[model samples]
Target: MAWNTLTCAALARNASRRLHHRALSTHPNPRPYTFHIGASWAGKPNEPHQRPKVPWPADGLIGSWRDRTLARPNRTTTSKDAGEDFFFIQEMRNQSILEGVSFGVADGVGGWVDSGVDPSLFSQALMYHSHRYSRNAWAGEPEIDPTLDYEEREQIEGWEMTPYECLDLAYGGVLREKFVQAGSSTACIISLNASSGLLRSANLGDSGFLIIRSSAVHYRQRAQTHFFNCPKQLTKLPANSGRRFSRACIDSPSEADVFETKLRDGDIVIAYTDGLSDNVFPSEMVTICSLVARAGGTEEEQVQAIADRIVEYARQCMKNKNRVSPFERDAARQGMFFRGGKPDDVTVVVAIVHETS
Candidate 1:
């Protein structure tokens, strides 16, 4: 603040932001590849208002990006679960089958509860706006359907949106939400350009994704944190409560870790929150998914099976006092003696990459 400092990180971010807002290719194909995606989530048993157990979502639970329901607020569940953690899954289409996919997960900071804010207000609203923000994005040049109303066209000024901008826009959306007065959350979101096979991501905090290829981890995000237990998180604080929530870590989507990679057919991407990460290991994830890989079916069926198994594994481990979990191991590393699993909300999103012939 003293010198209006311009550090190397600042310069890098500025350059990346420009690349992110650049116009998409003039000629866009409606379908270059189609992905089969599915999701599974649950509230920790100790959490209040949670059902005895959350059954897996229906097999045909797929959705369209154009499906207006995605843009709506998540009233579908009570505040307890998502006030803990939340997730979204949607497929993008133009006129044909599958054009691309946009999906992510968010974990609300439980610390907000002490400040009288329903944690879901921030995480859920952030996600609602995140899902809404592709609509919540930068103006570009191309892709507005001629049939759209003048206002609709204006909202989506036709161009590709980078994950960084989406997170930035979504964060702003939360700030404007009068209802979300104050709170914080960790988010990990992805934009898969099916046509070009490019996958771009923005992850802040510990919630993140991993790519599995040929039964092994092709890619995985290392959890970003300020110290042993406090991960990087996006937050908005109430002025009156600033002294109270002073220790809360505040992050902007700009500080998010941006990653890009070329995805190959059959690669499986599992994006999840720390609930799963803290409970399971990468080698364990490969082993769990291998069950469905051996008993294969259509991508839709396999995707559902994979999501179910992963969630179930985490749930079971959470309740098994004798079983040492990843979070427990990490606790030991930090010289804290905690046992078994760390019970928290769990969310898992699975996608299978498929290239059309």
Candidate 2:
């Protein structure tokens, strides 16, 4: 993979033209802000949602969290008990130095189970490699650039990597991992620069993030898909696998849609897998955020509550077949009929931004 998009010199040139700065940079910031992150998750069947003991803070650039104790199906995606979604929230760094934060959600393609592949394996590995790459900006092991294309002295830690670049490197990492076998996943990634107040994002499929401000949904990315219920995804095929898998909505991280926006104080960023969107409407999320934004402890605590409410509400919506859901609405638009909410692995990451005191 040509990760040249984030080379040191190239990034420096781009930085000169952008409004945001890496939080770890020594440059003077005219306006400083901090980000507080919170997240929630639940597998299929709408069990009680779970979250980290506490929300993540603006303290460091390398803090990361993953869920392992939750019970999920061991194999087939058709299993009602399966949870094929995965997610991560980690501070992005440049050579161990705090720069920004990167977070994302990945939903494994359940159909892979038909080919004897575990659906969770691909989604989990994708998040793992992406988090590792964002934490240190190196694909594989600690300091070594697994690509081994460049000389040691000039290896790139990605001075200010873009969301797509991060996805690209992580995609490379998955290819390097020999045990992955075969699978595919839809991903949406975000990079927030605190000092510059800029949000850079890359989305490859149904999983996406939304920007909520002033008690309303401000900006939302439309999902990319080949057709109704078939989202764009990145896949790794086995050596023997042929064109049979090629017809799937296979995509490359390079093709991810990218966007940039300047953030403001008290903005809410919600990133989630399709499960949330499929069940809960955008208007509903804005109402949830507005109601929960206040009556909070600290910044992170507030967002955590918001995250919890959104996921729990989505689960509730899933169990109700009486009302029309986002998924059903979308299917109707495509001339396909569907019932209530979709039941799949749900993962969410929420962030609240505040100006420095």
Kindly list the per-residue Cα lDDT of model 1 for residues 1-357, writing each as its tens digit: 111123212322222101011112344534455576766677766667322122222342212321233232221133324336777654444433344667889988777665566675567666766677554332222343669643354365333466776777778877776656787899998877666767888999999999999999999988989987788988988857747776778887888998989888888889999989999898888876776666545556566666766776787788877988999899899999989988887887888887653
Native-to-model Cα distance after best TM-score fit, residue 184 in candidate 1, in Å: 0.4
**lDDT by residue (tens digit), candidate 2, 1-357:** 121213322322222111122244354543376677776677887343232233223242212333331232121123323268887777765555455678888998888877777767777778877787676542111344456642232355554466787788777777776657778999998888755678988899899989998988999988998877888999998887777777766688887999989889999899999999999899988877766644435554466667766776777788888889998998899899899887777778888887663
Model 2, position 180, has a per-residue lDDT of: 73
TM-score list, all predictions: 0.77, 0.78
Once fitted onto the true fold, the runs of candidate 2 whose alpha carbons sit more than 4 angstroms away are 1-31, 46-82, 94-97, 137-158
**Total backbone clashes of model 1?**
1
Q: Please report the candidate that would top lDDT against the real structure.
A: 2
RMSD of 2: 12.1
